[model samples]
Target: MALPIVAMTLSSCGRAPELRVNDAVVILSPVDSNPAALYFTIHGGPEKVYLNSVLSRSVIRSEVHESKVDPKTGMVTMEPTRKIEIPAKGTVEFKRGGKHVMLWGVNRPARQLKELEAEFIFSNGDRIIVDAEVRAATAGDADKKDAHSGH
Candidate 1:
């Protein structure tokens, strides 16, 4: 009985942190555009996680951002966020009109290619790489449809 208990403990200790991104996408912009937004769902691991930053070869810089709406003004604004915390066994979603990754100074090739690789860096030194699909800004209907469907 003691041996079995010890084995279980060891198994639990060996569990590594896991991060997963679902339905990752980048919104397409014009040829000389300097800014774009990336959206996805980040599934957390067994431990609490912090999203430090986003990296992409297609962009000169990337930052995390959250959308805020003013009640009186009835206007929506995007604000820069330093980091995002995801609860253990939970998920953080970056969606349209919500939290998202902002990419600045995007290159022409990235816009034409319609595909790019994004890397998510975590406070725990864990990195997750994902391929993001590019879609036109006019595809709001399709984006909404995909958001509602289960990934």
Candidate 2:
């Protein structure tokens, strides 16, 4: 007589999550109302994301900007960047006191909270469209549903 045998198998049933970005905030100072700054964090995907360009109707132009803090001179300077690479499985945070987006030439005042259309052009030929809410400078105006929220 032979004993019966039993076996079990397991498998994954869902597609892997795609690369994305979150918590995109564009801050417009009261002084330089025309030109605004953008800050956001990029979520998972590949090792890096090439930010081709940024678009908005409210502003004439949008560019990636970075800040340089000099320890010796105790001075901080900022300049325009061609593109930004968001690390894969990592996080790229664009904060107020750090690297951000520079939006120039605003004809109207961005006082009230409004949804501004922004299409992020990537080197991979992928477009990530985000609705940026225009509010006060100090206001926490970041996307909550984005992957960057949990972190």
Candidate 3:
């Protein structure tokens, strides 16, 4: 019985990490000249996962970023990030005024697209493809407000 239990535990430990993305959206630039922001909720599997980067043919470049507010100055800023860690059996949210994927130099066709397909690359050599809804900056105001409030 003890040997069987040990074998089961070892097999489970070797399982690959699973990732699921939900509520994915892309906020297009108002003038189609600036970078777009991508938001989503990512759920990790049994093991912790590191999100290394995002890839899309629609944009010239893409990177992960984190937003922060200066409590004293009341100023908001965004900083580039290399990786985002998703806790095991937990979720990470990328929303407005928080951690998000930045897409730069979006092509004209992509900007006009209703939805875009993107690939999320993990540090452990796993890639997941997802379709993200496109939204204009003027749209999703209610969602943005909630995101800013950290809800």
Candidate 4:
């Protein structure tokens, strides 16, 4: 009599190797706009990740911006931030009313926003490059709400 072999496949839910992003979108601001913001959602990780900086040819300068609200004054302002942390096995969002990328001093008039590319520099020496699409400035609210809800 031949014995039947039993085989089992185990599924693993182990955390992803490192940090990553999803639903990444950049709303290209109109030409001549200064200090435009970029929003997106970052996912994945077994350890914490930080956003180091952002780079693009569309602007003269790039910086990380964090939005803070004054409880007493009921005012909001964006200021340069050191690093935005992404928790382990978790996610981080760059959204309006929160954190975002500030691109300043757009030099040329973006006709139809022909070339919009952004390089996301991560603290772990990882780079995620994304091409942003041209969108109307008025659509910021919709984009912000969608980003806040985790894209």
lDDT tens per residue, model 4, 15-113: 356676655555545444535667778885777778888888777887887777789987676678888887777878887788887766544554355
* Per-residue lDDT over 26-113 for candidate 2, one digit per residue giving the tens place of the 0 to 100 score: 6655555446676777775755667767887778877777776778986666777898886666677887556778777644644355
- Using lDDT as the measure, the top candidate is 3
Candidate 1's displacement at residue 38, Å, is 0.3
**Stretches of candidate 4 exceeding 4 Å from the true structure:** 1-9, 13-18, 28-31, 106-115, 139-151
- Candidate 1 stretches greater than 4 Å from native: 1-17, 139-151
lDDT (tens digit, per residue) of candidate 3 on 33-134: 667788999999878889999999888999898888889977777788899998998899998888999888767676577788889988778898998988
Per-candidate Cα lDDT values, in order, are 0.78, 0.65, 0.81, 0.66
- In model 3, state the lDDT of residue 84: 93
Q: What is the TM-score ranking, best to worst?
A: 3, 1, 4, 2
| Alpha-carbon shift of residue 118 in model 4 (angstroms) | 1.3
Quote each prediction's TM-score.
0.76, 0.73, 0.77, 0.74
lDDT of 1 by residue, 34-143 (tens): 46779999989989989999899989988898877789987777788899998887989998778988887766676678888899999899999998987666755445
In terms of TM-score, how similar is model 2 to the real structure?
0.73
Q: After superposition, how far is residue 52 of candidate 3 from its true place, in Å?
A: 0.6
Clashing pairs in 3: none
